[model samples]
Target: MMEVPRDLFIPPDALEVFLDTFQGPLDLLLYLIRKHNLEVLDIPMAELTRQYMAYVEIMRANQLELAAEYLLMTALLIEIKSRMLLPRPIIRTNEDDLDPRAELMRRLLEYEQMKLAAQRLNDIPQVERDFTLVQVLIEQTVAKRLPEVNVDDLRNAWITLVVRAQVNRHHRVTRAELSVRSHMSRIMRDLRGREFIEFNELFGPSAGVAEVVVTFLALLELVKESLVEISQSQPIGIIYVKSTDFLTSV
Candidate 1:
């Protein structure tokens, strides 16, 4: 310690020392490792712990507050140092293969990679930092914009359309499905006991046009198959449907 001279008034910030700042403990650890050219994978635990504790002492001497993270890292460094020096128990397990500094090395490597990537990004040319933006103002000769539509007018138009749709709405009749096979079987059964059946009597007026059409198709199919004969009693007389056997001489 040097003897202080009388009337030596030093300002609080006059003797301020600037230490290398780091983003976190990992950053500081990485700095130490790189500064000394030490291998991250094969780290010398004793030397690394000594230098780290020295930094913590320096921080204390400078009256800088040690963050919880820094303290935790300090404890970890000391623990790793001790784990290396002491003899590990002879346990036949995977723990034997695990290096105490493995976790630290992984974290440091990841942080260094990210830091390098960030440095590369920072080196890229930035818009505002590298150059100023140039702005120009021009007078508009003609500004054309589409007319705005009123919501009330659109609503009134929609209401008119709805009213017209309601007034012009027509009924949608979903006609029932009729089976031709069932109609054919029914016609055969009707003609079984009777010699002939009038075409008008075979079709029910209450049945829909679709059913009537299907019945007519079935009668036509029967005639085509020679299972039934459709013939007029006379010219312009009532049409009759009878079995082909009835028409046959046999």
Candidate 2:
């Protein structure tokens, strides 16, 4: 077994410390180029490759396994550097030959743009990170509703009242004299000065059915004689009685 030397285990340089934090080889390369203000279009491949290998050596010394992507990028940089060092064939042409660094520059530019966009997205307010979920207690009112009644319900109620009235009614027999002529005279006296009287006002609730019938007959007789007139605007409207003498005066 061979033992490694103590000098070989030296810590990475301060410049290479930032390399560990980079996302990928391109990110580290971009950082190095930008730090030195080197033009990406005209990169000094020799210096860039030296710095890249230094970081890689440090990673390997630290026993940190290098990613396949980073190793692949390192090989590409070495190949480009070698190609640049080789002698070129002289040829005259209208169009200029493509630069070896053009592809790398394009990739670097695209990676930089994507990185900036990622940073911007990360800076935006996140639901769980920047803010916490809030719960609110609210009071609400519940309404009490009453049952609805239809026309049939009202008719049933009326029938119940009629039945209850009949059950509570008292039977009595007495000889009470009532005359249509007397009722007519009394109605005429009431209408002497009045302009109009409602037909219902002529018969009160206290008046029995017999009295109401006689009063109604007396009203009809008065209308027949032209002494009183009953006027109603609509078929179901209230009937109003007016004496002919009172009408003539108006």
Candidate 3:
């Protein structure tokens, strides 16, 4: 018998031929069937076996280690091809003959379904890949409150001041000169350096009835001239006097 050389089956560029690697024999078989558009249930065993053997030869030539699963599938393909060539029995029965490709077809269909499901799961939105979660922090602040005063409270305070002045009144008659214009100028000078002043604080206990009256008139004249403002809050609260210059600047 003549011996064939081992190198005869291997191509010269076998090292350069890139083999399409697959997960298993079934994966390679499925790829081939799909590429050729062959029917899964009615596989053409002769053509399939020829192509499969050609791939196995390429693997061997490239020095690629063949797995046991690939070898088993190769044997099954050859057996199916050989059985297709043989004649069948003439005995009639209600059930049809079993297809050789039935098991392979079921496995391929299941694998394809699982592959599609995995792909769908991978496409779902992820925390970092698709979008990121955002968080915001805010700083809190404390509120401030200002004191309030009322008109009735100012009237009561004025009455008290007058009573106190009368209690400390002297019987000796003395004509102490007090001018409303001079008091007005003094009040304006006092208010210029300050923002607000309490209304009762403007008078002193030593100031007699004449000085208090003149000072009160001077304050009224300042209000009439729009130079100062008398403001209050509730029914009985501290009264405040503010310069119109401060109010305007604010």
Candidate 4:
């Protein structure tokens, strides 16, 4: 008797197969109807609705989140079923009788068509190509001697630094985020009278350690942009600055 009981044991997780795949109760019902090649307009609501609730029970057994939409769709199906079961006076005419489920059928057909179209589109190849119309042309104008550094040149470099730092990977806490542009503007205002200053001294203690580090990076970018020049006195000494060959075009 004991051996027979052990031998007769059934697999525990057989119901998990159904629960894992269903989007919701409605999706399961729709799938079952389609699999059986049943017309949506003539849905045997009593049978289909029972099957839907069974799928929901399976979902509940698996402790999955039961969305309210599933329950709502079930109620709608039941209502449509009750409406279909009612008696109505037959009108003798050439025009065909209207279906109660016509609206639901139309929606289903449209949705199925869209789904098939999307699948077909996904099969097409994707190609990458540079698509741009506007070309950047650098015009060589008549050489007219002007001041070494303009007010706007330094301002734009500061703007670029702030934008880059905000988007940089190293940033974490927003509270810890310091604006390099804010400090740069302050430094520029302070260095208005002096034409050149030592790079490290320019980023001195008024700005915190993090701000100083970002400012150094900003200076490098400014140099690369030809907005400023960096010069060293010896092998490893303080760097000097001179106005660049090109002023900010932007």
lDDT of 2 by residue, 1-250 (tens): 2222232333554434434577899997887788768888789999998877877776777567778988999999999898888776687354336667789989999999999999999999998899988989787655322223243543443344445445544478667699989999988987989987876678664566566668777887898898987765444455667888886665
Ranking by lDDT: 3, 2, 1, 4
Tens-digit lDDT track for model 1 on 16-45?
322335788898788779877899999998
Clashing pairs in 3: 149-233
Clashing residue pairs in all predictions, respectively, total: 0, 0, 1, 0
When sorted by TM-score, best at the front, the candidate numbers are 1, 2, 3, 4
Residue 63 displacement (Å), model 3: 0.4
TM-score of each: 0.48, 0.48, 0.45, 0.38
The pairs that clash in candidate 4 are: none
Instruction: List model 4 lDDT by residue over 71-101, tens digit each.
Output: 7877877787887787765863443356667
Better of 1 and 2 by lDDT: 2
- Model 3 lDDT per residue over 107-138, tens place: 87888788789889999998989999998887
On lDDT, the stronger of 3 and 4 is 3
Worst 10 residues of 1 by lDDT: 1-10
User: Model 1 clash pairs?
Assistant: none
lDDT of 2 at 197: 86
| Candidate 2, lDDT over the whole model | 0.73
Error (Å) of candidate 4 at residue 29 is 3.5
